[model samples]
Target: MPEPIELHHQGVERSIGCYLLDTDDGPALFDCGPSTTIAALKVGLAAEGLRLVDIRHLLLSHIHLDHAGAAGALVREHPALQVHVSEIGAPHLVDPSRLERSARRLYGDSFDTLWGELTPVPEANVHVVGDVVVGLACFPTPGHATHHVSYLDDDGTLYAGDAAGVRIQPGRYVMPPTPPPDFDLEAWQRTIDEMDRRAPERLALIHFGVADDPQRHLADLRLELFDWAEFVQGGASEEEFIAYGRAELADAGEDVAVYDVAMPLWQSYRGLARWAETR
Candidate 1:
C-alpha cells in the first residue's frame, strides 16, 4: 500500500493552517501556522511521531498569512527547507511588504500577534509551480485572495484554501471567508468548476479537517453563497443582511457555525467586514 499521508490541523482560528503530509520521499508539511502556533504545530507533529526538522517540504495553498503565515519563520528555523507556493503568490512570499500592508489594514497592530511576523521566503528556494505531473500542483482559486492558489496531491486530494469556502466540519455547511479587497464572485465560481473538474475524492479545508464528500459540500456552499448574494443584490441594508445571515445560520441547524460579519473574527471585521464587502 502507498504510505498513508498524515494530516494534522493546527492554528485554524489564528489563520494558521498547519498540516503534515507523509510521502514516500519523506514527510512534507502543508502550511505552517503563525509563529506562536508553531510550537503547537510542533507538538501536534510530534504527536503524529515526527518533528519540525523532519519535514522535507513545505507547500502552501496561498500567500495569505492564515494559510502561509509562518512560512518565513519556518524557513528561518530549518535553513535547508524548500518552500513551494503559487507563482502569483511566490513574489509576495519572498517580499511580504505588499502582503504586510494589506494585512495591517485588516489587522492593525495585532497582525503580529495573530499571524506572527511574516518573513520573506528566499526567492532561490521558491518555485512557481508550472507543471503538474512533476509532483505537487497549484490550482488557481482566486476571489478569496487574488493571489490565492491551492495544492493538489497526486492522491486526488485538494488542499483547498478559501477557494472552496469555509465550513466548520466535513458534513457541514459553508460560509464565504469574504474578507475584503479582492473577493471576486466570478473567479470563485470558475475555480469551483475547476475543482469539480479535478474530481478530488477528498478536500482539506484550512478552517477544519478533511472532507470526504466534495460534491455535496460544494452544493451546500453554493447555496449559502447565493443566499448571501441575493441578500446583497436585493438591496438589503448591512445590518439587516448580517442579521439575516445569522438567521439563516439558525435555519441551517446542523453542527452550527455563526460568525458575526459585523463583529469580525480577529481585529478588523474579525473576517466579517471583508466578507460583507465581498457580498
Candidate 2:
C-alpha cells in the first residue's frame, strides 16, 4: 500500500482534494474532484507517473458534484475502471440529470462553471459494496448525504469523506457540510457514534489532509453539528447564517475558501433547518 497522494485542484491548496491510492489490484483513486478540476487531476496523476486511464477503481464518498463529478468523465475515458459507490448514489451517477437540476436550484448559473457537465456512468461499471472495499471496510456514513459512505483502510485509516465534516487541520474547527433533503441529524449522530466505536487511529479527510487524532476530531465535529443544528433551528436567516459562519471560521483560523464552494454556510443552515422541521 503506497502512501495516499493528495491532488490539490485549481492551484488551491485546501479547497478540494482527490486522493490516489495504490493497491495490489491496480492504482485506485478516491473521490475524483469536480469535473472542472479534471485538468488538475490529470496533472497530479502525471506527476505520479500515471494517467486518468490508469485508475482501475474509483471510490466515491457520494455523488455530490464536488466529490464525484469527475467520475463520469473518468469512467468514460478509462474502459476498465470500476466505480465503487453507495447503492443509493449509484443510480444518480448513471444518470445525473436529476442531480444536476436539483443543484441548479441552489447554484444557479454557476452550476456548470463550478461543477462542469456530469456524464452518465454505465451500469456495468458500477460496484455497490457494503462496509468494505479491496480488503478495507466501508461504513454507510450518512447525514451529510443520504447516499454517503466512508471507507476505512486496513491500516486503520478512515477515508472520511464528508462523514467527519470539513476539518482542514487539527487546530481548525470542524464545520458540518449539511445540505438539503437528506441531512438527517439522527443518522449523522449515529454515524458519529459508529466512527467512535471503530476508533480509527488516523482520519483521511477529503477536504484536505490527514489527521492522526481521530477521537478529538470526531468529538469536535459531533459538538459542532449539534451547535449548528440548534443555531439553525433558532430561525436565523441565510444571511445571518453566513455571517455567523464567517465569524466562526475566522475565529478558528480556517481558510474562508470553503465558503466559495458548494458546501457553504447557507446550505448548512438550510439542511439543518429542514431536518429540524421534519424531525
Candidate 3:
C-alpha cells in the first residue's frame, strides 16, 4: 500500500496529497501538489528520508495545477528528474501560459495564493506516457479532464487522480469532481466502466487517501456523478447544488469544510451546468 504525503493545501488536512512509491526504475511520485504547498511537500519528503533530488520520476495524472503544478519547480531544482504525462498534457507542461491564463481567469485574485507559480517544464524533462510508465500500466482515464490518465501498479493500486472521484477517507460519500471545460457525463461513465474492468484492489486518490475497496467506491462515484449531472440538468441553482452536496457530506459524518477544500462544490456545479448546456 502506498501512503500519501499530505501537502496540506491552504492549511487544510487531507485536502491534497501525493504518493511516493518505488518504481521499476526508481522512486517516483504519483502527483505533486501545487507550488504553494511545496514547502510542506518537502517536509513530508524529508520525513520519508528522501530529498527532492532522490526522486527520479514524477508520474502526473493530468496537468491540473493541484496535481502537477510543482513539476517545473521540482525539475528546475533537480535537473535529473523526469516528468511523465499524457500526450495531450505534455505540451501544457512544457508551456503553461495557456493553462495559467485559463486558471487565472477562473481563480482571479486568489490564483497566486491558491496555486502559486505555474512554471514551464523543460521539454527535455517531459516524457509522454505510453502503455507503460516507469513500471505502472498507464491508461487514459479522461472525464475529470480531457488529458487525464491513471497509473496502475503491479500490485493493483490505481493512481486515480480525480477520475475515481473525491471521498475523504473514513467518510463513505463519494463526490465526483466535475470541473468545467471538460466534464462529459458519457465519457466519465465509460471511464467508470474501464476502471471496473481494470479491477484495481485499491484506489490511490489525490484528493485524500487510499481506498481499499475499489468496486464499491467506483460504484458510489458512478451513481453520485449521474445524480449530480441530473440535478444540474434539471436547473438546480448553484446555491441549491452546494446545499445538496453539503447535506450529503453532513449526512456521512464528514467534515464539510475539508471536503469542500479538497473539491469545491461550486466548481462541480459549474462543470455539470456546462455539460447540461451542451446537451
Candidate 4:
C-alpha cells in the first residue's frame, strides 16, 4: 500500500518543531530548521519507522536559515534529492550569499554553529514554484518576508509559511510573524482576507502543526499582528522590539511541542520587528 503523506514532528528549539510529510512519492521535509534540528528530525522519523534517506524532496517555504539553512547539506547528504521553493526564493538557495549575509547580521558567530555551512542548490536542481500549484499554490505572504509564500494544498489546508501569523496558544491567540524587510500589514491582511475567501479547513504553520479553525485563527492573527505592530511602532527600537517580542511571545500557552518544532521563533521575531520599524 502506498502510504498517505504524514506530518512528522521534529521538535526544534525547546519551543518549536518542524513538520515533514511522508508520502508515496517518498518522504518530503517541508523545512530543515536550523541545522541543529536535523538530528531531532531523524529521531522523529525513526520513531515512525522511517529515515532521512527516504526524503526525496525538500519543500522550503523560504530560504531563511531556520526554514532551509541545510538545503545544501541535505542535497549533499542525499545526492538524488531535489528542493521546491518559491521563484523569488530560488536564487538564495542557488547562491546563498544574500541568505548567509542576512543570517550573519542576525546571528553573528553563532550562525555557523546554528545553521551549518549552506551552499547553493544547483540551478538544475532548483524547483521555482511561482504562483501555480503542483497540487499546491504559492500564495504571497508579505508580512513575514518579502519573498514569503504560503502553499495551499487541494484540500484547502494552507501551508501558511508565517502568512496566517503565529499561533502558539491553544485558545487561538495569534501574533504576526512580521519580521523585518517585508512587514506589510496592509499586504498581510489582504492576503489573509484572500485566503479567508478560499476558506481552508486547516493551516499548517512552519513553526508548528495545523490550525483547523481558520476564522478564529485569522481573527486572532489579525488583531495580534497589528497589536504587535502598534506596540513596536510606539517607541521601541529594533533591538528593544526583538527583546520585548520574545518575552511577550513566551506567554502563549500551546503545547511545548508547538514551539518545540522551531526554536527561537526569534528569527521571525527579529525580522518582523524590522518591518515594524519601517512601517
Candidate 5:
C-alpha cells in the first residue's frame, strides 16, 4: 500500500487528522475526525481522486467526537460502510442519546457548532473491531478512554488512536490528552508499556501525522504523561492549569487555534486531577 494520506481538518491545522489507507480490498479510513469537518474530508478525498463512497472500512481508535463524530454521517451517506470500533463504544454509537446529552453538558452552546450533527449509527452496521475485520487486529488499549483500541496490521503499523497521545508535529514535544471521565494514569502507563512491547514500526496518531521512532516516542510520551499528572497534582487552579498547558503547546510550536480547539486544557487538567485524587 502507498503512504497513508493525511486529511487535515479546517479549524485545527494539525490538531485533528483522519488517515486514509489504501488496502487490498478498497480504501479504509482510520478516524473520521469530527462531524464538523465532513465537507472538508470529502474535499480532501476528492483531491486524491476519491470520494466517500470509496471507503469500505471505518476503523475508529475510539468513539470520541474528534475521532469518531463523523462516523454516523459517513455510515448514513454510505450504508454499506462497516464501522469497526471497540465493543464498549459500539452501543454508544448505536444509541447516542446519552452520549449526546453528556456532550451537550460538557460543550454547552458550542456543542452543535463544534460537533455538528451526530446521528445514531445503525446497530446492524456497527461491529466490534476483532469480530469483523478480516486481517487487521484490534488491541484493547484503554487509558485514554475505556472504549479505546488500537489497530495493528500485518506490517507492524499501529493506528494508535489516542492511546499513544497526541503529537501534532514530528520533532515536537508530545502532549498528553488526559480528558475527563476516564483518564486513568495507571491504565495509561500500562498501555504505554504494552505499545512499547508491540514495537510498531510506525504509529499513526489521530491528532496528527505518523511517528517512525516507536521507542523514543513512547518513552517521551510515557514520561510526559506522568510529569503532567504530577503538575496537576500540585493543586494549581483552573486558570493556572490552562496557562501552563497553553505555554507548553505554544513552546511545542502549535498554533493558537490548534491549542484552543484541540488542547481542551482545563478539561484535560480536570481529568488528570480527578485521576490523581481518586487514586
Candidate 6:
C-alpha cells in the first residue's frame, strides 16, 4: 500500500493528502492537492527523490479543487505529464472558468487563500480514462459528484477520492462529504454496492490516509451517509446538523476539528439540505 504525502492543508496535519505510486508507465500521482499546497507537495516529492518533471501521469478521481486543483499548475511545470480523468471531468480541466465560478460562489472571500489558482490543463494533455488507465481498472463511482470515479490498482488498492467518504484514520469515525449540486443518496448507495462487490483490500483516500480494512471502513461510511441524509431530510437546520455531527464525532472519540478540516460538517449539511430539497 502507498502512504499519503500529507499536504498539511492550512498547516493542519492529515487534513489533505495525495499519493505517489509507480505505474506501468512511470511515477504517477493519485490525486494532487490544491495549488495552495504545491510547495508542500514539492517538498514531499523531493523527500522521495523525485522532481515535478519526474512524474509522468496524474490520475484524478474527480475535478474538485482539493483533489485536482493543482492539475494545470503541475502540468505547466511538467508539460510532459499526462492527466487521466473521468470523461465528464476532462473538459472542466481544460477550461475551468465554470468550476471556478461555482467554487467561488461557495467559498466566497476565502476562495483564493483556500485554493490559490485554478489553472487550465491543456486539452492535449488531458485523457478521458476508460476501463484501464496506466494499468489500473478505472470505473465510475459517482454520487459524491456526477463526475466522480475511482481507480483500482493491481494490488487491490482503490483510489477512492470522496466516494469512500472521509475518515481521518486512526480515527474510528467515517463521515460523508456530500457537497452541493450532486449529492444523490440513491446514486451513492449504488456506488457503495459496486465498491463492496469489487472488495478491494485497501482504500487510498485523498482526504487523509489509506485504510487496510475496506469492509469495515465502507460500512461505517454507508451508515453515516444515510444517517446524515435522513437527518437533513427530517428538517434539521444547519446549526442542528452541525451540533448533531459534532456530538456523533465526540461520541466516537474522534477529533471534531480534524474531521471538520477533512470534510466540513457544515458543507456536508448544505449538500444534504440541497439533496433533500431536490428530492
TM per candidate? 0.83, 0.94, 0.99, 0.81, 0.93, 0.99
- Least lDDT summed over 10 consecutive residues: which range in candidate 1? 1-10
Model 3, runs deviating above 4 Å: none
Model 2 per-residue lDDT tens digits across residues 56-109? 899889998889998888888887899999989999988889999999998899
In Å, residue 147's CA in model 6 sits off its true spot by: 0.5
Per-residue alpha-carbon lDDT of candidate 1 for residues 197-250, written as tens digits (9 for 90 to 100)? 888888887665577888987777766666665556666665676566566557
> How would the candidate models be sorted by lDDT, starting from the highest?
3, 6, 2, 5, 1, 4
Q: Give the TM-score of candidate 4.
A: 0.81
Worst 10 residues of 5 by lDDT: 1-10
Model 6: how far is 93 from its true place, Å?
A: 0.4
lDDT of each: 0.67, 0.82, 0.92, 0.66, 0.81, 0.92
Per-residue lDDT over 110-134 for candidate 3, one digit per residue giving the tens place of the 0 to 100 score:
9999999988999999999999999
Clash counts for the predictions, in order: 8, 2, 0, 16, 0, 0
Model 3 / residue 89 / CA error / Å:
0.6
lDDT tens digits, residue span 125-224, model 4: 7887767545466667665666777776666667776777666534355656655566677887887788788788888765445777888888878887
Q: What are the clashing pairs of model 6? A: none
Off by more than 4 A, model 2: 1-11
Give the per-residue lDDT of model 6 (tens digit) for 1-279.
689998988889989999999999999999999999999999999999999999999999999999999999999989999999999999999999999999999989989999999999999999999999999999999889999999999999999999998888777677899999888889998999999999999998887799999999999889888888888989999999999999988999988888877888888888899999987
The positional error of residue 148 in candidate 1, measured at the CA in angstroms, is: 1.9
| Evaluation by TM-score, superior candidate among 4 and 6 | 6
Model 4 off-target regions past 4 Å?
A: 1-14, 22-26, 169-171, 237-279
